[model samples]
Target: MLKKEEVKKVVRPEAPQYVKDVVEHPPFRVTTNTTLETLASYLRKFPIDVVPVFKSIFSEDVAGVVYPHTSLLIKSKKLDAKIGDFLNPPIVVKESWKIENVAEILIAESKWGAVVVDEEGKYVGIVTLRGLLSALALKEPKAKSVAAIYTPLGEKKSRAGFVKAIERVSKIFKKLVGGEVDGYVVLSRENGAVGILTIWDFVKSRRWYRGAGEPRPLFGTRVTRGESKHTGVVRVWRIMFRGVAVATPETPVEEVAKYMATTGLYVVPVVDKDQRVIGAVTVWDILHAYLYGPKEGREDIEVRKAIEIVVEKPTLETAIGIRPSKHVTGLRARDVMLTDIPSVNIRDTLSRIRKVFLRSRSSIVAVLDDGGKIVGFITRRDFLTYIAEKSLGYWKRQKGKMLILKEQVAPGETVRILVEEGTAGDIMKTNYPVVAPNTTVEEIAYKMLAAGTDYVVIVGEDNTPIGVVTKDELIKAFKERGRKAKVGELMTPAEIATVNFFASLHSVIKKINAYELDGVVVTEGNDIKGVVSVDDLALRPIEETLRGEKIIFFTKSGVLRKVSTGLRRLRYSKVGTLMAFDVMRPVSLNISINNDVGEIIDKLLENGVLPVFDEQGRLVGVLNKMDIVKDLARVYITYAMPEKVAEVKEMEREIKQS
Candidate 1:
């Protein structure tokens, strides 16, 4: 185990740096009085995403910012209008702000950049994602592994399916737009990381339909007839970009940024030796690293003595082998279901459904029959899909004008018109998944996953809609149950993978990736020294001398062989030189094996893995969210539906065999 003094030696605090050091002059600026045509010309001339709009040139007061995409909302006839009408508020920060603080603000707001202001609120310059990356590339500070910056996908967010799963597109889109993930890492049982889907891919593959009469701006209010049928049946695989660049946990953040810059890829999957994706690195992550160095430190554990206690006592409503009844002992659909669900009559127009969504701020709205029975449903995602299908071309005026004098409108107006004219029954989905009010939360999870939806509707005995359960509710239930369950009940047994203390960094990474282990126990002879997990190894700094170094180690047979650092030399440097003791974190199992899983939930999430120890302080097992979720699901399945036990067992057997 590493001592407190040793742990302090590994901590690297960055020197103070302000945003002014990296700020650059704005490439172009527009005034509020500028014509839309002038703004469009400037946007076309300069390859920039956001343009700062000033209240006046002399005052240098920022009114707002305009994105290149904002043009899609304007009508051709309105091009002469002032640009101020469509301005979005700009994110402004003081020049004295720390780079990391600015990065956090931008990340939180999902903005690409912010306008730098002086103490008096005068515009000084702009700091953008690109500018930060370019500055960091030039500085080339000590490189850190991608693991420190990448976002882990865990079991719930990761997707495994056939490449042609068109129905999964909507779910993936929701995840992307909702900020759940930067991209979807498409996995395969046989092939591992097969492909990746990002927002850029969706933007590039956007197709316009001419059969929808005329295309208008994305936000146009004009009504049109009929809808495009192409988008619904199209396979996502056809649009998914393949053969994307991949990174390993050991890959340096600098290298990942370089790949992203050289290629047009915005998201890169961090895979293991077997090519299975464990996490993803996005442009935003790279910017984060540039601002805040490699992320370090494990969450402190709170020690609690082991005691004999029942984790959960079954009630008559939840007894094993008994049929599930209303309001089970644990969380159920009724407990988390939303009773005030948004809805629209079957005969209501799409315009009405849109109003409900905006007013209620709901993701899904139920389509009800005259008797108040749910016949179908429409989601915000559905509206996005509808817009995508119809906003492909310019809408041409059909009457009161010559062929050359026909008025042109944006796709938004055309799509808006189509939606207003269509009835709820036209676009509402009837195949949505549903569950009974008495259904267990875990069962609802299964249904949502199988149905490729984020929510499940709960109905009463008469088959009338009662409430709705969403991912938010499911997460709340898991957290509550997790707090009551003991670590022993959720942990993976102590038969863990191990590596020698003298092992090369290459070997350590190979072991981790080969077995798909979150980390490995570092051993010196028969005793454990420390643990070297992916997160641990990622925090190790890359030195110039370590690059391309040759490492020689002896095998059990006493034969010594040399290994090159390879192309990713910065990451694969000889661990013997850097010392595994420097990279591995101290292994102190303060978290008791018998303690509630909730005590370590925050730590497990932060470090990605934790070791469990028994009463006598003997290494017993490891605990992670992946194992806990799997166990919880299994337990819930058995308790709620006894008849499915055999089938669930069969599925588990196949999983183990695979």
Candidate 2:
């Protein structure tokens, strides 16, 4: 166990003066006026999957929302389309407030929270729902859903007691599957009551007892569908800190990584002195910069002149993840920042913010002003605060505990009593803690630790907050800045290395290695779109690797049954039917191509698919897996084509109108 102070004192050598500054990452904002086509192009440029939507719709004082996975965006992008109209308000926030405030607001809204304006109407940072949850994971009490009270089913049972044993297990399984008492039971095989088996043992079924024969696959009567639907409709509500982070042009590189890591973020959007997201510095880039300093140094003295002390033009495309993490431990600011990123207007919403966050896995919403300068931050936490405050107000009104504002009081008569009633304005914090890219650990750590707040808004020399620095970050840097005797510096502009969206995941993977990267920036021209990370492509299952030629069958029980002897495949329908004769192998399961779900799960649980096959073996479609869950997410529905989908557009319109 480590005390907060103890954690703060172990100065990380990598976090030298150089790390405080940065190189490059991603830009924060985009305009609502930009068409969805433009936004889709951005999605292909980055590794993230979500972006924040900013700007109000209908000339109202709020920005609405949009998502990439929904059919609305995907359909248009796949066919070169755009969002014809705005949907919802964007998540907004002020830079001065605590990050936790955003978490509170999100919970109250029962929707993704949006951090809007203060009473005086100043734009702040936008926080996502997950951003709030991330902060809460570290600094707040957490809630966990309690499932069922589980107990082991005794293994003791007699051959006569087998029926009873199965019954108990079934009851428990039913409760869990039925969504009743959320719990599971252990399975067991009791020769009598004394012999016991666990639920784990039951699920790990090896070979059931056959009266006088060798082990054989159990035949289930049920059948199921194997095809998955990628085109189904889904509802998605996403939030992003649709903004960027700013640092003084001179901030150190190591400190920049420290700033980003403490917030549990990988990319810190770097801004110029003007508060523009000029570039970005990622953890790997800054780490490389720090390591650049300690390599066979000629001498410790003359720190600025030390060999390889500064990082120049440090694009991942150049260095990639080439050097070991051990190196680049004390390099300078000039070594790490990638100058070329993207930028968007604050009024831009629905496209970049929601999708970029999804691809980059970053939380900060970099708010940029009219000149493409970062001026504010939008974090998930900010949204939570707004919703919570509003929800509290709603409840107060319901309980008649709400206070009337002085502004709403009558002007002429004695409205002093009414004026005494307060408004949410009376309780909202006017002064919130924030930092700028140039702010040092010592300067900001004190504020963060004292307040127990994690997110700090990063501003520029102009006093406008451009990004954010959390409490965790300040502590990390403050402790580490003291250890190293030498440091590095960087000042070159950063550049992005992008790939075409239509490129195969394989091609993207190849490009990553060429760059020696953990991820690649997917982009179009100058705008950011999406990001592709190594992790994103790592788990893809390869076909033609299932070990051997396979055979499928359905048992009387309706479960998918596979029987393989490393030679041939077989499908069976019924056990004692005339179709069983002259059969080289028995086909167990049968299937149909229709899209009904409830009918499928029931058939699958029986054993495998249904139906008996003919001698000619000309067959219909088969069933394998349910797309119910897949349809819930954003996926490319393959079996159903797009043209066939448009016929139902009227249904979509009707629901929207209703």
Candidate 3:
């Protein structure tokens, strides 16, 4: 794996000293001196996706633009029209702001691109929609996910607190980058909105995601390893997930969600005075308890607590289960127990940990050492990231490296690093930080960035593994599943060999094919470090797993607007497969011969339920629609010379004569 230092060089760097240091100058631009005919013809010939709006106001003052299909030089139109007529008010940002903030503006505005402005308000460069999207990756959500949160700063902060923050950040990453975006924890600088704390800060700081748990709300599944005939077998200690900050068995209707939110864990484990694992809490359970039960439509976060404030603590017999299911009227640690939680011993092989988890329908596997004490846990998603990090192969001949003092990278560094390395482990990281099973999400996000890793192993009192929590687990707290549970209640334990980190790209495929598992865990010795997916490794060509083919469209920004507006004209709202959630906004493509056209076409089709892209990323030309017409003839071949407009008009005139 790439050393944390190497990754930092590309991610962080000191401030640039000069005006020209941060911005790229001489960026491609278009001028007002051009004629409509020439502009239209130029758009077709040029490969760059966007054209600079260059009018006489300032050499770099971007004013307006025109699209590929646009024209005004017709028989009835003026030939001297300038492209400035179509320019819209420019959206600009200072080069000093981090790209993370830039992305927020981009997503909110839904514009073609944003302009980079200097302190003096002079234009520097532009970040197109495609450029911004290329800088970041978006993802679809997982099944049964929620986002519980944690604060980066709290009264408990210290060395342990900082590490906890890193662990929480690693967990949040499960939802932010490759995973889906769920609910988020707002880390206020002073706990009173003094300043904003963002995920990027955690990453730039190299902190790990130390949240309560990933994809929280452990509901079911129990597993037992195959019998060993040797000296009999070992029985691991069942983790007691009590006193883990959950609603009281007697917590009232409204207070449950508020308490769940405070913990930033999906399921808050309920416990008795003995601190034994009794009942469980999940977002799904709370939703049902409130929606279909006594509290019909109250969205208040403190209703259950509200009852506690007014009425005194009542007797358990009367307060516990007034309703038929004994779930809604009152709840406690015992009423919602997910009896047989999956767990294992530290001495167990990593492969076995993988099996116990796959066998159990739970989110993680809990592990104990020789004395049957809880050590830590492992989640399926982190297992996958570990696999991907370890499986990464490099071509030493192409190795290059970039040193970022801060979170900034350039194209040159990427090329240099790729040409260098040869082995997979040469690019993987080891000896990262971890978190405790009981740590709250509020405390873990702060330390995540400093560690530079993406996950935290949740261990029980005796250093025995119980479960793994990830960023995705935190986000899932609110989006779809259980929120009344704690991190231990939801985490997946490392049981069967979670898989190896450096297995041949081919070997992993065979394992996935053989076991039919979700993905194989990648590990070092007995410890689970990472995991590999069948989807990324199943292809024949080894490099196919490394990079993806991309496509581009060259057009003026106007066409992009027209097309996107047309597609969204129906304006349907609701979440389902039918909704084209991944539809593209108007995007400009920088077409070049070096890229794969087939891959681009496939990606386009995969995104929008249709195949199409115009010069300006508009639907003026549909892929399927174009194909049918092409089949009707041989192909769409342009004439060597322009068809005579006079002849065409004369043909219409002759029809009237007839």
TM-score against truth, every candidate? 0.35, 0.21, 0.24
Q: How well does candidate 1 score on lDDT at residue 176?
A: 50
Question: Candidate 1, residues 1-658: lDDT per residue as tens digits?
Answer: 8787777645732332677776766456678888766665554334343578888877677888865545433332364678788788989989898766876887788766788888998888777655555445434433366767666766354322223324456545545534455455565554355556654444333241111234453456643556534344444565565434456676666655544433324567667655566767777767766766654541212211112212222222221222222222377888889988777999886446655765675667888889987788876545433422343211111121111111212111111122224567876888878889888777776566446455788988988777887654564566666436788866656554555665544455555443334566666765677666543332222221100111111111100111321212122111112234334655655667788776667676555567777898776766644444344445556666566676645666798999
Clashes of each: 17, 198, 148
**Prediction 1 TM-score vs. true:** 0.35
Error of 2 at 624 (Å): 45
- Order of all candidates by TM-score, from best down to worst? 1, 3, 2
Best by lDDT: 1
Q: RMSDs, each prediction? A: 25.8, 33.9, 35.8
- What does candidate 3 score on TM? 0.24
lDDT tens string, model 3, 548-624? 11101111112122454333221111111100111122222322222233334343222221222235432221122
Q: What lDDT does each candidate get? A: 0.54, 0.30, 0.32
Runs of candidate 1 exceeding 4 Å displacement: 1-18, 25-49, 56-59, 67-86, 96-98, 137-143, 154-242, 260-266, 287-658
1-658 per-residue lDDT for model 2 (tens digits): 9777777756421211210111112233444655655554454332121244545333433355443322123322333343436445555555445544443443344333454455476543344432332232232121110001101122221111122233433333332222222111111242212112221121222111111232333365322454334322211101011111223334444333323322223333333333333333333233223323321322222111001112133332122111111111232222222222233346544223434434544433455567766644443233223322332111111112222221211111111222233222222233457655544443343344333233455545787644455422322332233222110111011132344433433344344343333344443354333444332232111111000111111111111122341112211111111111111123334333332334334443232222211244423222211111112101111122334234345545687999
